[model samples]
Target: MLIGEVARRSGVSARMLRHYDTLGLVRPTGRTVGGYREYSPEDIRRIFHVEGLRSLGLSLSQIGRALDEAGFTPSTLVGDLIRKTEERLNREQELLERLRTVDAAEPSGWQDVLRIVELLHGLGSQSAARRLQAVLAPAEGVSVPAEMLAEAVLTESDPNVAGALRWALARAGGDGVASVASGMASEDVDVRRRVVLALAELPGDEATVVLTDALGDPDTTTRRHAALALGARGVTQAVPELVGTVLTGPNDVEAAELLGTLAQDAKWADRIMSALVYGLTAHAADSAVRMRLTQALAEMPGTTALDTLRQLSRDDDRAVALIASALVEKLEKRLDDELGQP
Candidate 1:
């Protein structure tokens, strides 16, 4: 076959075939009387082989090595191609995400587009200050899309920047809830923790629902954060975790305070008291836990909590007895004051 026929059959353009010949990638096996290049059957097979390697993302040099080098193996090169393809895919995915976020912003013009793009770059910047500024203050009149803020909050590592992003996400209202909620499905504990934190700031039933689901998160920290947020919103579902926090804690005091606030509701009061009493009984050997529980019990209203405090005042542990005794006195005084007793 001549170059024209070879090009017609193989789909390799004659110009490209000539280029391949120049590079010694696939030289035609013979020549006609007019000195035009002619390809033998074996030469046509080599052309297809080169095209096949090219389809796998092989550079011309790599293809040359693959076709001609005796020791060349597909294993190492294919592995490298896979890695490079994965990297390219990742980059493309990131770009697609960036474009989607920008489109979600619905920029009215090129200026708005540029400002939003700048704000996004700032949010992803390595400098914590830039990330903070991006959330706290964006370009004039450029509204940062809640979706962008949601994405940033999930990956933000700096404490200050994360807090700012959460605050901004909350102020963005329930608009960002779905985006933040989607992150809850992540197997990454840190990401889920951030998701709950962001959801906690977001108001409305959407965020509340996601937070309620987070109560059962496998990650302890994620659960605790979710519980605290739910408790603040007066979600009674947080009671068990709050009670658990009082039993064993890093933020026992906060948990105790929020539990007390929840106890203000007449219906939940007894339940809250019962959980606390159960905690006191379950952790009988853990005096420190008992002490924390004792303090928490004082936050409850009505005679029930007062009676519980009176009973604990005479407990075996001297420290428990002393703390409970002090709390009992305070509770009595408060109850008396409420009743207008002399």
Candidate 2:
């Protein structure tokens, strides 16, 4: 069979089929004497597998690897594909249940639509509230017009709606969502922020570019969300940017909190401690930054972080002093127990 035949039978575009071929996802098994690509029965089987996996949210890369790893077992791969789809379906059903409780009539379906938009995009907030009324309509049943949903999903120019879509894409959680998030990353600030958050939900090679792009977002809140998302991925590849976020991005409480959580990794602890120390130095300069950083450092577990907090207690800054003294006292008790008995 030719590419056209594969496209017709699989319901994938001819161009996309060609692209998939280049990705080595679904390749022709042979070629004709005239040089046209010749696909085999085995190739057709693999094409269906590729289509099924693509539907279930597997990336071309993921599907190709899975195909190779599964040794092309049609039945087994189908089951695996079904399981992945089922997981996403379950999550969507949960969202549907929550949607029922969230009074859609209260505000023209703004919040409910926005939630779906967020799930579609990755992250959003109330300021984007007005934008939600358009994306989500008040429909009781699940049978929304595909074109209506697609138009709402794609045509809206509202930054908030774009952001909401990014959030929704994140919640979508699969290769398909990752692809959508990747495209959304190039949008405006609010949209990009949502895209970063969405990428966090679907962490993959596609996410790497968005996360890196987010580090430079001018909006402090967006940057904070990006930092938190990167922290959750725990991508060591992201350590440098995470360090930058801690040291200079924005004086945000949530970002600081995320940095502390990320410090649990031994590879990241020294850098986290450095950021804490820098934040402490500025404690005398900015009270708000001081308080947030102090709160952040206290939550960091283990001796190294605790000891640093103890030392900071000696500072003239009262917030720093209080948290450090408390943590040090706790550490002392732990040390005594560890060293006293055996």
lDDT of 1 by residue, 1-342 (tens): 899999999999999999999999999989999999999999999999999989999999999998899998889889999999999999999999989988988888999889988998898888999888888889888888888888888899898999999888877753699988899989889999999888888888888999999989988888898999999999999999998888889788889989999988989988999889888778888889888998888677655687778888988889889988898888788789989999
Candidate 2 off by > 4 Å: 1-179, 182-187, 216-221, 237-253, 282-284
Q: Across residues 1-342, which tens digit of lDDT does each residue of candidate 2 receive?
A: 887787788787888877877988887988888887778989889888888877766678878887887565556767777898899899898677445424322335575565544433421224455446433432332222222232234444566666555444444433444444443545566555555555565546666667766667777656666666776666554444554555554534555556667777777788777867776675557665565566667656566667666666785777767876887788778778878943
lDDT of 2 at 105: 21
Error of 2 at 30 (Å): 71
Q: In model 2, how large is the Cα lDDT of residue 62?
A: 74
lDDT of 1: 0.89
Instruction: Please give the TM-score that candidate 2 achieves against the real structure.
Output: 0.48
List TM-scores for all candidates, in order.
Answer: 0.93, 0.48
